[model samples]
Target: MRRYETIFIASPTLTDEQAEELVKHFEGIIAEQNGELLKTEKWGRKKLAYEVQKFSEGYYTLFDMNAGPTLIAELERRFRNHDSVIKYMSVRMDEQTKAAERQKVRYEREGRRKAQAGIKERSLEEVMG
Candidate 1:
């Protein structure tokens, strides 16, 4: 399974419940297709760079998942068919991208560890002195 990131904008007129239902519907598709959903984020309504479907703002949602080609095709097909979806895009994360993400995470973890260690060392020195 390859990793993918998908973002879609839903019509701003949708009620909060309707928007939540839309997200759940897509999530069900991923699960039914044997895809692993890694993360989901709702960015809420935001201004677009330009008007889309004659609406200046839309509810933005993002999905990060691992799935095969067939699942991706099905997911995109659903997106295209859904009326509330104003704009959508999906990008496959290649080996290079995955490596970069892992490297970034490692750096963050190391930085945190070092900061904690430095704090502990300073406290010990002050006490001993």
Candidate 2:
């Protein structure tokens, strides 16, 4: 599995209940595909940089997940088929980026452990003493 980020814009005309249903629809897809959804952020109704589908604003939703390529393809296909979806994008995060994130967590964890253990780096004289 690889980490992926997807941001999609839905038609602003949708009612709150309709919008929630749309969000749940996609979330269900991820679950059905055996993918893990890391995060879902709804940035409701923002002005578009430019008009799309003759609409000046859209309801934005972002998804972060760990999934295989097939899930991404399926999600994109579904997005394209849905009339309410005005725009969508999916990007796969590189392993280097993932590794760096893990490395940062590992470093912080080690630092906390060292602090708890009362272990600190010392100069040669301090070590000898």
Candidate 3:
């Protein structure tokens, strides 16, 4: 399985319940195809950068998951056939990006440790003086 991120915009004209159902529908597809869904975010209705499918606003949803190429292909095919989906995009998180993220987290953790140690040392120096 490979890390993947997918974002889709749904028609804003849908009722809240309808929108939620639509989200669940796609999430179900991922599970059925053996995909691991790490996160799901429903970023409520927002104005689009430009008109799409004759609509100026849309409900945005994001999916972070791990799945193979066949799963991705099927997911995209579903999106293309779904009328409620105004637009969608899927991206595979490459190995280089994952390594860089790990390195960044490591660096941040080290920096925090150093800062805490410095603070403790400063407080000790003041008390001793």
> What's the lDDT for residue 10 in model 3?
97
> What is the C-alpha RMSD, rounded to one decimal, of candidate 2?
7.3
Candidate 2's TM-score reads: 0.74
Q: Give the top-scoring candidate (TM-score).
A: 3
Compose the digit string of candidate 2's lDDT tens values, residues 99-123.
8999999999998999999999688
TM-score for each candidate, following the candidate numbering: 0.74, 0.74, 0.75
Clashes of 1: 0
Across 1-129, the per-residue lDDT of candidate 3 in tens digits comes to 899999999999999999999999999999999999999999999999999989999999999999999999999999999999999999988776988999999988887998988844357768899
Task: Please list the residue runs of candidate 3 whose C-alpha ends up more than 4 Å from where it truly belongs after superposition.
Answer: 95-129
lDDT per residue as tens, model 1, 1-129: 999999999999999899999999999999999999999999988999999989999999999999999999999999999999999998898776988999999988887998988844357768899
Off by over 4 Å in 1: 98-129
Model 2 misplaced stretches (Cα beyond 4 Å)? 95-129
- lDDT (C-alpha, whole model) for all candidates: 0.93, 0.94, 0.95
